[model samples]
Target chain A: MSRETILASIRAALPPGQALPELDNFGLHYDDPIQQFITTAEAVGANLQSVDNRGGIAAAVQAFLPGASSILSHVPEVPCKNFTRDADRDPHAYSDLDLIVVEGLIPVAENAAIWVPDSQYDDHAAMVLTQHQVIIVRASDLVDHMHQAYAKVAAAEVPRFGFFLSGPTKTADIEQSLVLGAQGTRSLLIIMIRDESTSTI
Target chain B: MIDHAQHARNFTANAERTAWHDDALWFVREKRDKATKLIPEWEELREQASQVKMHMLSRLDHYLEEFERNATARGIQVHWAEDADAHNRIVHAILERKGVKNIVKSKSMLTEECHLNPYLAERGMDVIDTDLGERIVQMRNEPPSHLVMPAIHIKKAEIGDLFHEQLGTDAGADDPKYLTEAARQHLRPKYLEADAGITGVNFAIADTGGIVVCTNEGNADLGTSLPPIQIHCMGMEKLLPRLEHLGVFTRLLARSATGQPITTFTSHFHGPKPGGEMHVVIVNNGRSAILAKPEFRRSLSCIRCAACLNTCPIYRRSGGYSYGSVVPGPIGSVLSPAMDLEKYAALPFASTLCGSCTDVCPVKIDLHDQLLAWRKYVVKEGYLDKGKARQMKMAGKLLSSPTLYRTASFLSKGMKLVPRVLLYNKKNKWGMERELPLPAKRRFRDLYRKRPRS
Candidate 1:
């Protein structure tokens, strides 16, 4: 009954429809998108690292967070001693995780955001519950803007959920002071793999 | 009647705090300017975003139905609420059926509008606000001042005292990083223990049957991901026609909000996670009435970026609490009066009609024009105070009659000879905080008559 009432009211309030604007030329592009991505990513407080292949991710992770004790790695290239993917396990089980390494699908150069779908991991909480996060994105998978990134997302298989993660969990709530790791991941590291053949990682 | 001027006077009484607040907001506005400058197509993007919103408003019914169908097909439960009470009841009913005890909420202004936390708390449900700023305010038992930076009104030292009292932090520990870490430690358990998660919708895509929530702290994701049940409360106006529109809105949102390239997490939820339940509560709550008024309809297009609040000179100086509403800026001034004309009639007069808010609005809502329109409606509806109404009527008559205006102008030149006490007495409201300008040596009419003809 409320549904019908709301819909009727909306219809009654409707005015003559206007045309939606074309978004063909809405987004901006840089001459060097990767360089722009690095600059923007660092500005947002994300650490950037260049890895040659999937094998180098382990070394890079160790170098980035040497003291990480409890690790959760969704990427098979980077094995962890702490925990493995368990679909039925309670998400709270990953609450004490020190680091989480997952693969990013597409990286947007404009905002330095990496698209990570739910299908990439068994538990969604692992992405944000950890102290530090490492997202492995291919250099070739970088797009110029969100428009291009969304195009890729629209074309891909629809996940139940996904996100364009730009940086670590941060907040400027108290006196507009930028504080990283406010309620979630304390730090974010993007490992850009330049080797094209290492896609399966 | 809600006296905004009196409340503003209370806030401005502390001159030092007022200047600090003004400088803080101006700093954010400058950051916004710098961020937007990076994109060469920024103005065009705003135009495209505004047109898209207008188009969506025109066919709102069609899109709402489309969104409901697509979302329901994806196994997300869809519910509609005719008003705020209905919204609170629907959410409570869902949580009640699930036997949820403890709940965590992200920064959803709709819930704040509905007073959902108190409603649920009265029924013995424990509701925790998970956003750091929101948590701080919740602890202090206050409402958010600004939309984006909720705790911007409270200084670091106050927060330090609050944390020391609530979370047992060291005394005099006023560093933002330390206070934020204390909040992080305190809220993580709430997220882990929450039986349900409630979040506000940033944008809902009709074509994709999903909603996008943007946050820097990722609390929304954490709260919703672990909970067995998740509820997303959204105003009907948040609907977008397609997923591509997100590309446009997401680009403009953070740049306009906090001057970030983007919020850290732009999470998209198509439906519930595996073995988890998700519900979308679409609440009307005076929005349909707003849509019916062509003059005020564009106010519904706001994305809650708080750019208008940051750029508004009055908001900067007077602070958000002075507005006496859930939202407290130029957009709030226009929207609040429409909710209750008699109670909020004074809100429209709170601004200087500077139009800075209009220039910075991502959706290009004519905020100052709407304020002016609301003032006309307020006067026509006889909501203005009796004394002000009589003075305005007298001024109107004098301005319409050239002879009366000229006579008054001529007589007013003699006011310089009068003592300041007689001129700035209780009858002169304008002279309360301002000085009357000195009269010209000769009348403007005489000077114009003697001017050399070009």
Candidate 2:
């Protein structure tokens, strides 16, 4: 077979979705970093010190969450692992906390905002924001953020999608009327966590 | 069809476009440097971003399944499409069910991958591009040459002329603000009258079934907020593991893309509006196949920030249309081959292997390396012109063996016939536009041997 046809056949065979199969799913469900933080943070419910990756909201809760709670946070970055690590490939490579504000407890940006996790791989390494002052936001805020994002992308161009998701940029290119959110990412959520160590300040 | 062969011709032939391409990309490179150089921790951040994408890609299946379950629980319908046709059919079928012919849309590359707007238009629905730059290119019936700045290839006066012809602007009005206002006024009616809104997802959080989009223009708010039905198209690779990582990305994205401290607006989403219907389409296209290749997986880490486009020397010269896809520049080179290698056979070779693009890329994709990899693929695919193939094989054979190489080098010492027809004539793409170098009468190897034996 022609190499072109062979490659296309292989491309055709692969399944499409959000994540690759078999790499992360052993069908084994376990509490990852976010899950563990969620379990521990909710147990304390007020001011609590976290081991790592759980400070942005722990501090926010101490400051606001209905109770007079104290502050505690951990230095999120630990010692490096035993691999050949380079920080150049992926910058947002750090493992971070999942933050949430049930009653809009933390003020991040002007609106409710949640921190996004970073990526890591062979080409790029992650940049862990050490002891970062993270934001905690409401679930509702994520919805609002998505709606706005949807509109921005809908109006964008398709070819420019590589440049920042251009297909979402809504334009009257097909017709002479203005449209919104044609690209369709609906909301954003920001979770704030405060490790008790940072809260000590 | 993109009519890629023909469009590619238009892109390379336009000298003005070439100049605009250079200046436009240079401006992007400058912006990327401003973003990356600012943080002493910038290199570290790129690594983090790449690793995060890799991990997300690694666990992509689980996260997508998790997302589908959660999104469905939250009343959002999730659909899987393996290709552009499937994605378009699903979206069109959904819109047909709603009986909505007029729809407002934000930017979405997936739809472009599916050619969704045109597909819908063929069905008689009206789709509007909400972003100002998108609107400009859409109106001109031209593909955007650059990713971030859509009309970066278009001069403001040309836009004025286009608006004057299409939108009825006053004959000498060339003001950016004035023209912008005209477009806004012209498009406001669609936002209100449209029945559904379409958008593209910048980042999809599988953990929480959420999305994040950042924009300088506030058009996204106008597109989705004023519409009742919303559909979001997300490339499967656009997944993130957590929300905390957003802080790192938002800090780096706009600064790298356009030199802004941050995009004027960055929004996140979890579900539908209180009363609206929400649909999410996850598209694979060639992503799964791409992920399987260890060398090529890093291409998926692209944040769609177009920083590399700005720094690419060849891209500045040939422009985006030469690549013949919606996504252009360095990312486009990596992506196009995955989608359809034969069609984009020329794209990988378009680069000069300058590597400046890789240096400026925010996520630090080894773009030049990818381009080099593509060259091998094209040759192996048998897509290269036979004459070129023959020449390459002959050269390879000659160089790989010292005797053949020495014989060829000896033969070329006094040979004037080779240069006149082989490399310096109209038949060669390189010689078509630039001056062909005159071949030296004596070979450098022969002259060095004749010198002293030091």
- Which candidate comes out best when scored by DockQ? 1
Residue-level lDDT of model 1, residues A1-201, one tens digit each, is 999999999999987789988776554667887798899899999999988887788899899999888888888777776776677888898888899888999999999999999877878888888889999899889999888888889887668899999989899998988998888889999999888886564
Model 1, B1-454: lDDT tens digits are 7888899999999999999999999999999999999888888889999999999999999999999999999999999999999999999999999899999999998998899999999999999998888998999999999998889999999999999999999999999999888888898889988999999999999998999999999999999999989999999999999898888899999999989999999999998988889999999999999999999999999999999999999999999989988889999999899889998999999899999999999999999999999999999999997767877889999999999999999988898998999878767666788899988889889899999998
Candidate 1 segments exceeding 4 Å error: A195-201, B442-444
Q: Candidate 1 iRMS, in Å?
A: 0.9
List runs of model 2 lying over 4 Å from the truth: A1-201, B1-17, B410-423, B427-454
DockQ of 1: 0.86
TM-score of each: 0.98, 0.68
**lDDT by candidate, in order shown:** 0.91, 0.59
Query: Which 10-residue window in model 2 chain B sums to the lowest lDDT?
Result: B1-10
RMSD, every candidate, angstroms: 1.4, 14.7
For residues B264-321, what per-residue lDDT tens digits would candidate 2 score against the true structure? Answer: 3455555665556788888877777887777787888888888877777767776677
